[model samples]
Target: MITAENLTKRYGKTLAVDALSFSAPRGAITAFLGPNGAGKSTTMRMVMGLDRPSRGSALIDGKRVQDLPAVPRTVGAMLEMGNHQPRMSARAYLGWQAHSARLPRTRVSEVLELTGLASAARRQVGSFSLGMRQRLGIASALLGDPENLILDEPINGLDPQGVLWVRSLLTHLAAQGRTIFISSHLLAEVEAVADRIVVIGRGRLITECSMAELRERAGTRATIVSTPDAKKLVRVLREDGAQVESELSAQEVVRVFDRSASQVGEMAAEHSLRLHGLLQEKVTLEQAFMELTAGAVEFRDGGQEPSATAVPSAMSDGDPQ
Candidate 1:
């Protein structure tokens, strides 16, 4: 398992990561999430031992990353794409990493095929497209076939099919009892695969829980009622203490929050209202994430600039997508 105990980082007078604590257990996929300037990248770097923490610790299996014997064989991380030599072929690059880690060269060919880069294995890194580079990065991380994987934006440049392939690959790896910790802006995909979520904002821990727990805590369920008498229904629902909202473009549509479909239907029936359609709308991950991080956003369009103390200097909190 990957665990952080008050993991903090600071650059000069600016604090990049606060006292953040969380864990990504084995046999599960945990998604690390936050908005721009939320210090996600910095935190990941700290966990990998690439950046020293100002306080606290980042641990893998109860040991610090640097203290772990044969670190490459124990954990594999893909923090960014396109960090390889541009003149090297995909196969040659993986070979170099495998050689450095004392891993068998056969693993190079295995990961290339696993990441769907076997056909492009001989292509120079500079010639590879964005998606291909992403695949190569993942291949390099899997070169050691470590039991724990930490990937940052692994699906950034992938196409729809590529995204699906990644989803399947992560699922397959997790099923084998590997710990998969990834950070992605793709909320829908995260929702589909993540067993737990850790959300941070402004360099502090916001929330961390399982997918089901997040849905429950957010209470993201609403009922949609379509009727010709939307205006009257809205008034009645408001009088009955139901939070009602209407679609500006579709006057016939009304959304009632914190109420179930049956409850809304009964209310409509009691008021002798004609309902054209009634259905419950499940709150999506995107909606819940937005609600949970609404106040944590560091940058906003046409919003006031944050005070100097509120913004980090040396290391901007924004993840360079």
Candidate 2:
């Protein structure tokens, strides 16, 4: 398991990472999520010993990563892309990593194939596309057959197929009892793959829980109903203190909030109302994430507001006077 205890970092007067702590267990994909400038990269750097923490510790199996005797064998991290030697071929690069870690040369071939880079093994790193480069970087990380993996934006430029491959690969790795900790901006993909989620904002822990638990906290579901007795149903639902709204303009469809489909159905039966449709719209993980991090967004667009588009005073009715 990977554990972080009060890991903190500061740059000049700016506290990049606050006292943050979390644990990622083995046999599970733990997703780290945050908006831009939320200290995700800083925290990952601290964990990998690339950056020093102003205070606290990042422990891998009870020891600092820097103190690991066989660093690559214990942890494999792809913190960034485009960090490879431009002129070196993919095969040569993996061979270099293998040599540094004193691993058998055949291991390079294994990872190349495992990461679907066997065909491009002889291509120069500089000639590879962003997606191919991402694959090559992952191959380097797997070169050591480490028990833990830390990847940052691994699917940054991947196509649909590439993204699926990554999702499946992470799932397979975690199933093998390896610790998989990932940070990504792809919420839909994360929702589908992550077994646990840790969200941080402004360098502090915002919330951490299973995917199901986090959705439950969102609690903004609505019941969609299509009934012939729309007027009566709306009145009855409103009397029950449920917020009802039209689902579409000039349509019989209505959405009832703060209530479930079953509740609406039962109410309809109690009053002998004919129901054509009834369904509940559950909160999606993406919605929950947005709501949770809305206040914590560090950077926002500086564009003019909608009201700012109003006609200028000199161009208005009084201007010609």
Candidate 3:
């Protein structure tokens, strides 16, 4: 397991990382998420022993990374895919890493095939696209077949097919009981693959929990009701101690926050009102993230605030897609 115990970092007078504490457990994929300048890179650097922490420690299996024996065999990290020798071929790069780690030379080819880089093994590092470079970096990390993998934005630049491939690869790795901790800004992709998420903002930890737990804690679920007597239903729902809002397009619809579809349906039925539709709208990961990090945002444009927008409502034309 990877553990951060009150990990803090300071660059001159600026506190880059606050006293953050969390764990990336084994046999699961944990996604690290944060806004710009939220100190995600700094934390990852500390974990890899690339940067000295101002206070506290980052430990793997109860030992600091610098103190670990055979670091490559214990943990593999890929922070920057672009930081590589330009003239080296993909195969040569992995071969060098394998040699340095005292790993079998054959392992280089194994990782190449594992990362789908066997076809382009002979390609020059300088000539490969960003996506291919990412694959090469991953191949190097996996060359040692370490039990833990720490990757920062492993899908920075990739087409749809490449994205899917990376997702499948990470999921498969986690299924093999390897500890996979990744940092990404792609929330949609993260939601699809990550079993747990750690979110930080402004150098402070905001939340860390499973995706399902985070959604449940978001505390934002609404019942969307479509009926001909929208105004009457809205009044009735409010009178029943439910907060409601209305939206009128071609058809009449109302949103009852903190209420379930079943409750709304029963209430409408008791009132003898005909209902066209009823949907229980739950908070998505994107919505939960936006709400959680709203106050922690260190930088913002001169645009509307996050709180200004309502939970995306279902259109009266049809249920939410």
Candidate 4:
């Protein structure tokens, strides 16, 4: 497991990471999410001891990562594993990692097979596709067969098939009791794999909670059902401090935004109204996460909202085409 407390980091005049604290539990996939320039990279670097924190501490297995003996044996990190030597073959490159880390030679081929790169093991690193490069990075990370995995944007350039492959692999690793702490801006994908979310915005912790808890805090949406009596119900609900909206169906779906479902249920009973349908909309982890980070994102400075147009493009494909 990884634990960070009041983790702070700074550069010259810029505070990169600000007082972040969270526990990445074992036997679970913990997702780290943030907007651009939210200090994700810096925090990861600090955890790996590639960078020092100006304040606070990040611990792995109950000890500071830097203090661990042979950290590579306990923590496997796949950060920006984009570096490559054009002339070096994939096999040779991975072999070098084994040599440097004193990892067993047999483990290299195992990771290659696990990442589906055994077929291209002889090819030069520079000739590998972007997807292949990501696999290679993952291979190196698993080389030590560490108990912890820290992957930053593991699906960044993956095609749909590659994305699914990565997801399954991470899930399997966590199932075997490894602590998987992955960072990604992809909400829907993270929702599937992550058991918990640690969100940061503008270099600070927004909230850390399980997927279900976050949605509960955000409140499930209620579809207001109405007819001509909808107007009366809407007014009554409004007077009761409930939020109501008119629907395109010529019906007003009463949404008790902050009200509990039980409260709404009780209110609906008291009205003695014959309702068509009273539905509570399910709030996905993505929506709840977006709401929490909405105002604090570093991407917006003038308070301008992001275009809804970008959401679709950012979504992972429904299936591999």
Q: Is candidate 1 or candidate 4 better by lDDT?
A: 1
Question: Where is model 3 more than 4 Å wrong at Cα?
Answer: 228-232, 271-273, 303-321
lDDT of each: 0.88, 0.84, 0.83, 0.79
Report the C-alpha displacement of residue 292, candidate 3, in angstroms. Answer: 2.3
Q: Against the correct fold, how does model 3 do in TM-score?
A: 0.88
Q: Please give, for residues 194-306, the per-residue lDDT of candidate 2 as tens digits.
A: 99999987778999898878877876578999877888888899998989997544558989988888899999999999998898898887888888888767545796342
Off by over 4 Å in 2: 248-251, 272-276, 302-321
Which lDDT tens digits does candidate 1 get at residues 1-321? 999999988777777788999999999999999987888998999899998899999999888889998888889999866588999999998899999999999999899999999999899999998999999989988888898999999988999999999999999999999999999988999999999999998789989999999877766477988898888889999999999899745648999997888988888899999999998887788998898888888767888886454544333237322
Candidate 1's C-alpha runs over 4 A off are 227-251, 266-276, 313-321
Model 2: ten consecutive residues of lowest lDDT: 312-321
All-Cα superposition RMSD per candidate = 2.8, 8.8, 8.0, 6.7
Worst 10 residues of 3 by lDDT: 312-321
Collision count for each candidate, in order: 2, 0, 0, 2
- In the predicted model 1, the residue pairs found to clash are 37-317, 37-318
Q: Compared with the true structure, what per-residue lDDT tens digits does model 3 show for residues 113-160?
A: 988889988888999998888888888888778889999889888889
Q: How much does candidate 4 score in TM-score?
A: 0.80
Rank ordering of all candidates by lDDT, starting from the highest: 1, 2, 3, 4
Colliding pairs, model 2: none
Kindly report which residue pairs in candidate 4 clash with one another. Answer: 224-253, 224-254
